[model samples]
Target: MDWTALWLSMRLAAWTVAILLPISVLMGRFLAYRQFRAKGMVEALVMLPLVLPPTVFGFYLLVAFGRNSPVGDLWQGLFGHQLVFSFEGLVVASVIFNLPFAVQPAQRGFEAIPVEVREAASCCGMSPLASLWKVELPLAWPGLMTAMVLTFAHTLGEFGIVLMVGGSIPGETKTIAISIYDKVQGFDDRSAGIMSAVLVAISLFTIALTYWLSARMGRRLS
Candidate 1:
């Protein structure tokens, strides 16, 4: 068992979830409430990753984050290091790759809120921000949990994007999925099986727990 790789995957998933939570909430709320031009286009763009091939998406990200690109150059100049093959790079890639998993559920949750409830919140003198923090969030808690779990699990299993962006740098960018691949390629079937089993168990538990909790919460609410 590669403890370093296991820890790194956990850290990456945790960081991705942390960064995405507030962003998902804001974007979800905006999409839920706003009627704007190209709304369908905007949604399609947000959802593109879900349908796009991971390697193809990763190839573009590789070019965009390579040393020659403006954003890449700026980051290197300021931070004194390139972003590629780094843990930070993995986090960024994971966040982008798993964004829809976090945002779509949250958006649906927000949309599920009744118009009457929002109107009542306004009538009770709650500002939009206040209502979001108090009323909207409470009602949408289950969806938010689903978003976080999905993102975490998705990040845990990422291979293509993380590999393209971060490469396999142990203790830095090598995640469990990559580690499993490496082990298998090296004919280390026992190690690969162990890691693969761990991933499967974790994913199964998270998905099962998420649905169970959602069902329990629904029953309570009803």
Candidate 2:
């Protein structure tokens, strides 16, 4: 396996996690607590990526961020470059592709906390934001961590969107999944196996970490 692709994939996953963490946390909290008009519709929209085809997401992203569209041109004007065919593009695609992975778990975590706890905090005159930061977030820390790890892992495994938006730019956008695909296409079975093994090891380690953390959190909460 080319160490470069492994490194690139790791970098991409790390960046994706860093970018998605706060956004997902806020979204998860909103979905859990906010009862607004079309709340169900908002939840459905958030879950859409899970059911949407990866290629279709990639295709739309390409058009939306490509050099021609209004948003794309506006971005180009501000950034002096296009979003498509770049690492930045892959980051955007990964965020969109793996959004639900981060949101759903975090939302569930927030939901798991009793409403009475929030009510007690409110009774004590704590602002909503303060209650969230001091009460809800700590209780949901394990779930947040799980969401982050899972989202990172899922993005690392993404292929179609990365290929479409980033164009397999080796050393920049050629993540592990794309590299494995290329190796297999070129009949380089050995390299493909090596990459696959690495990915599997990482995924297994993550799953174990999540379970352990969840159990620990359960004990602590109890």
Candidate 3:
């Protein structure tokens, strides 16, 4: 097992979760509370990654972030390196690829908050943000927790997108999933099995913990 790849995968997942949590909260709240034009289209766009093939999505990302593209050129000029095949690039890809896993649950959570509670918060002169922070979030803790767990876990198992965007660069962009693929291709079945088992164990533990916490939060809310 490549410890560096394991560490990189953890780092990528952590960064993806950290960046998306607040963004998911905001997007989820908006979709839950707002009734705007093109809402369905926006929601569909947000969910596109969930349904789209990961490699296809990563191909677009590669183009968008490649040195030939405008964004890539600008990024390169400013940062002195292309975004493609970098750790930062991996984070960006992970965030996009796992966005729906984070956003959908959070949106559902926000929607579950009773209108009366929000009205009460309003009556008490709390701002919208304050109401969300104090009332809706407390009531919808389960959904938020689910989003975080799903996002982290989804990122851990990512393969096609990470491979397309970052390739397999040990300690730089090679994640555990990529490492596992490499091990298997190299005929290192023992290492591949060990890494695969570790991922399965981690994923199972995360899912179980999420469910347990969600159930507890539901009881508390009730």
Best by TM-score, which number?
3
Better of 2 and 3 by TM-score: 3
Off by over 4 Å in 2: none
Q: Considering summed lDDT, which 10 consecutive residues are worst modelled in model 1?
A: 138-147
Q: What is the lDDT of every predicted structure here?
A: 0.91, 0.87, 0.92
Roughly what TM-score does model 3 have, to 2 decimal places?
0.97
Q: Return the TM-score for each candidate structure.
A: 0.96, 0.94, 0.97
Worst 10 residues of 3 by lDDT: 213-222
Candidate 2 lDDT, 104-130, residue by residue in tens:
889988988898998999999999889
> Candidate 3 — what's its lDDT?
0.92
**Top model number, lDDT:** 3
Question: What TM-score quantifies how close candidate 2 is to the native fold?
Answer: 0.94
Candidate 2, residue 102: the lDDT equals 89
lDDT string for model 1 (1-222, tens) is 898999999999999999999989988888988899988998898899999999999998889989999878988998999988889888888888888999999999999999899989999999988998889998888878889999999999988889889989999999999999999999999999998999899899989999999899899789
lDDT of 2 at 16: 87
Clash count for candidate 3 is 0
